[model samples]
Target: MFDGVHLGHQSIISKLNAISKGKDLESAILTFWPHPRKVFSPSDDLKLLNTIEEKKYLLEKNDLQHLFLKEFDEDFRNLTGEEFVKQVLVNKLKVQHLIIGYDHTFGKNKSGDFSLLKKLGPECGFEVEQVEAVNYKDLNISSTQIRNALSSGEIISANEMLGYNYSITGKVVHGKKIGRTIGYPTANIEVDAIKLLPKKGAYIVDVFVNNTPYKGMLSIGTNPTVEGKLITTEVYILDFNDDIYGEEISVNFRDFLHEEIKFESLEKLIDQLDLDKKRTDEYLF
Candidate 1:
């Protein structure tokens, strides 16, 4: 229930499993909605790996149950971390242990760090566990790296850490309908949140249309190469045809094929696409 929920966060989950084994107690998690940061500071650069809905799906993949979806509000933010544990976690939920990240912080102004936890644990009737950071090579695995990789069009490296392809979730909406003439009809998805987006370019990806996954190429940009405005995500599903307007679909980028290129002529753009398709097949498959 944290932002990004990166690989390093798995340490907390693993600790929960290690503690829960043979205890016959269900493992649970708690997270906030709309993000405390988003509520505190809204921005245009806000990017997310998964929406709230997608986050729930991801948590379930780890066999996690009892997700306490807390709303971000002044009342919740005002509570001291000790108060939160004493009243909410211990008194209410009867939790015996709390697992947190290596750099975990809580309470108003994040004053309740690990040191405070150690002092208050016996008072609160629970124990605390901290998970060290997980690393890939010398780099400590983090969500920031994943976002940086995607924003720089390093889709392959990003996927390697994520253990799967990177994806964005949005609802399909109307577009200029110009790609039809170019022999590639794309379904445009109108974004409604501050989800993170990849760099402005075309990349080979797997688009999840409903429950079925299709091999495809996605464009995430303001159409700079096409002289069009309005940042959009357009995907062209391959080897299949269907009308998907006004539908919710996710676009999962698998590999970075090439950067967004501007052509002097539409014919030139089409020719480049032909090579992109060929490379996409070889790299993605």
Candidate 2:
């Protein structure tokens, strides 16, 4: 729905769980898939921090039992604010209590908000609870801020706002084998499909391979020294070796160490990689 399921959305969901107490009420999340923006009009700028599959997996960590994956279409978008509530919440889910953020909105033209919900709650037989805005050291927490921080490579503050580490998921693809030729075997990951990638640099990463976690270092850029031109995510697993071909890996980026730089020679690049490997060892150990 939003760019990422950052700390602000986590706060709202936490509030919903708190109000439920010990009643054992079934909690559900209704979010659009393929993104509303993508459906309405596609843009290269509309990069998603979490794919819908990843979002569903993350939501499983919360108290929510299920997610209603709604396809955003012009028809669904045409509904007025009140009709949306009538169909989705009242008639369909029979929702007894609805929890949302203070500024959250739905329906056509975003005619729904905390104020509108309050005006209509009495007739709908539901109680609307709007959680107060989340704040971080006197600053408001928002998805937009997190995205901006990521685009600027301010991952520390961005991860703080996400309440978790910065992460990405992708499928392993075949690369030019230039890293293997240079003695540092790497697993190349394709990242441009629908995920938001981090800054081009070296990162201490934890890679989930076949459901097992492994410490790794990732390089996020085109290799100028190796004569590679396309941007690729190349990961070197620490003290681990396996044929991970065609395996999908979920990588959690721990820290941004440096920007990707072009070395004058391949030998210099290899020398720099030695230091990179050692720094990665220190990070994960």
> Candidate 1 — what's its lDDT?
0.78
Candidate 2: give its CA RMSD in angstroms.
1.9
Query: How would you encode candidate 2's per-residue C-alpha lDDT over 69-183 as one tens digit per residue?
Result: 8888889989889999998889998887888875788888888888878888999988888878878768778877777777777778888988888788678888888888888
In each prediction, how many residue pairs overlap at the backbone (N, C-alpha, C within less than 3 A)? 2, 0
lDDT of each: 0.78, 0.80
Q: Mind giving the per-residue lDDT tens digits that candidate 1 earns over 1-285?
A: 465666777667777877877576778888888777766676635677777877887776777767888898888888898788777788777887788887778878886888887787888777887888877767877777888887899888777777676778778888888788898788897765657788888988877887798888888777665798777888888876888887888877787767777688888877887887777667635
User: lDDT value for candidate 2?
Assistant: 0.80
* Per-model TM against the reference: 0.92, 0.92
RMSD of 1: 1.9
- Alpha-carbon error at 268 in model 2, in Å? 1.6
